[model samples]
Target: MTETAVEQFTEHQRKRGKRVSVVSPLDAPFFETERGSLILGDCLQTLKSLPANSVDLFVTSPPYDGQPKYGNGEKYERDWYRDFFMAVSAEILRTLKPHGSFVLNYRSKRRGAERGVLQYEMIFWLREQGFLFCEDFIWGKPSPPPGKFNRFLKDAVEYCFQFSKTNDWQFFPENCLSPARWDAKDRERRKKLAHNYVRANAPSGQGRKRVQAGPDMVRPSTLLHLEPEFSPNPVKHPARFPVELPSFFIKLLTQPGQLVVDPFGGTGTTGLAAERLDRRWLLVEIDPTYASIVPTRFENGR
Candidate 1:
């Protein structure tokens, strides 16, 4: 039998003193670290190989419909796009744990005068498929591309839709809190106000003389104001999202040692975030060219 490309790649990495393995029966992992595996294959096929109720979180920004740049010079028709993602979503629903979350980062493109409604349609479809609609986070890009449109404003925000298989899904909002901006004077004023409110509302002799101010860290809002990678050409992947995007979700929805999977891994950004956050990850990318560069990104501390 011929050695697969991934097998050869694994051998090469092993020669470099890196601890790597190709343990999957379907295919050897293109690259493996202590905490993650980058697989080179179709995501749907790879996802099918996994057991049901195994994934802890599914986070990915799949290729947009009708985007030729990501696809190989051929535009994906709306019907084809819907069919493809629906198939993938079915697998995601099957594999995702009952207490897990799936965060989909997607944006629709405008055509001549009309904006696409596929993104919204997918949300409805997902809900119908029994996945609970948890919340939606707006990824506000601080530096969006400049464009002059006749009918619309500049596109600066993308949607990160969160879904869960059951109502009892795991979420740890405290882990992703934003720093509070209250000074000592502000804290003192709030504390005094809180004390007065308590005193007025309490029973005749039950009121306390003082009350502490709120926590130093507050819950983050739904709107995430994060800048994309500064460099025009940060990586070989054409549509790579900022690492902070996945990092935020990982911190919010998972603990230290859970499993996170990105079926449409582009340049393995999700895998990098998972590794940094001490979670196990699996990244599946169909494009070999894109999958090949993932190891380099990991090696260079990207």
Candidate 2:
């Protein structure tokens, strides 16, 4: 919780648990914002040292075995993929605050007519680890046409699986809604266009300025509409989420000054999102090359 703990860095390889040389200052991201600090290293060892139940939230997507390589030059063979997920999930459970939430983002691939087992397995394991299940939201990426697969159009969406350690969790609906609201005429028109559909009228305001109101059209069961930005990467990690993605969760589950940790901090998108939202953050990346690039990423922010 103090700067001293984070200032002291230690490296431990699996073979020899002995501590190595101190991390050079060049490895740090310029702490431009007071909201958070970013650390670069193997997540498992780094997380072990943190105070248990100290982190306010855990928001990250771990590397899946069969997914495209993340450009780390290391291939995770599928044979032992389940074991890998378990190991990492256990570490995540440990650091989560008693009432904190841990949200995971993952894409499920189709093998023939069936979907991958990762989603189902993850939900089960995560619950067993004491996390209460919250509904899953689909992150529909509407652009960048799907690949030419045989039967389907293949509009792939990322899943945001939300979980919390305790029933008393934080989620601010105000943070996730669009700024603009529909007016009475707009709602009436939309409702008339589709019978049986209901649209809440926008709130009225005083003076010349229209006070934007009327509960946002109830969020559709599924989320669509996104513009593609190149995945954030100094080392060019393959899979990355939009900064808006983290903004959604941060606004929903945490308050300003609460800590956010991303175990797989590729290109530091999560850190960037946290920076903008005024939340503290800790990022762990195994690749040295990617670690070195974290600071340069701050030049551009959400």
Candidate 3:
């Protein structure tokens, strides 16, 4: 008997001290690697096949309702879009581990002279479905497209809404700390303020007390500054987020070898980030064209 590619990959991972547990629920994956699998299917249906409490983290940027540039020629209405994702969210709730996290990268589309409230509506709907609303992180695009508008400034940010199955979700703030922004002079000032506070609170008879400067690295804020990155391939997906976007959440919410899933796996950006971080991933992409690029991405070491 010969070992299949997936079996070989699984065994290889196990020998390297990684727990290989993510498996394709479908008959076979469109593409498979040592650290991930890409399944070509409608995510709504495929996600339902995954066993309950299987996925550790879900990171994805779903297609906006009327955006047909994603190779889908049809434009979906707002109500249909909401219903579609609500069904998807129900499955996510079922598939996610009790302590797992779901990070949705989304932005509402603008209609005529006013901005749509779809993003907020989705948030409210998700909470109603029993997903605990965690925190909303903003992805600030430093290099927004150059344009002038009559009634609005350039759209410079998108929302990354974090949700969890339970309050006891796994989160490692230390893993996602950023370097302290203050310089030497600022540090000295902060130290002086801390010392003054300690001295003022202590009695006159007490010995003089010292306060240490703050940590060199501080916890990251909800706002993240990440410039969008283009795909190295000439034929690129219409919408692809920077790898840093998913990498941050993967580091904060998951451990090595845990399973991470991206339902709307456009060009496999989430899988790429997960693989590099030593986490297993399962990606479901409906478009075959976008799905074809994923294996090449991994093969070319992008």
Tell me each candidate's TM-score: 0.85, 0.75, 0.86
Query: Candidate 2 on 173-283: residue-level lDDT in tens?
Result: 666666445777775665545444444554663323233344544443336356555654445666667888887788888988899988888667898999888899988
lDDT of each: 0.84, 0.68, 0.84
Q: State the lDDT of candidate 1 residue by residue for 183-301, as single tens digits.
A: 88887777667444444345665656665555789999999998876543433565779899999999999999999999999788899999989999999987665666677667777
Model 1 gets an lDDT of 0.84
**TM-score, model 1 to reference:** 0.85
Which should have the higher TM-score, number 1 or number 2?
Answer: 1
Worst 10 residues of 2 by lDDT: 5-14
lDDT of 3: 0.84
Error of 1 at 208 (Å): 12
After superposing candidate 2, which stretches have Cα over 4 Å from the reference? 1-33, 77-81, 179-186, 189-224, 231-234
Task: Give the clashing pairs for model 2.
Answer: 202-213, 203-213, 203-214
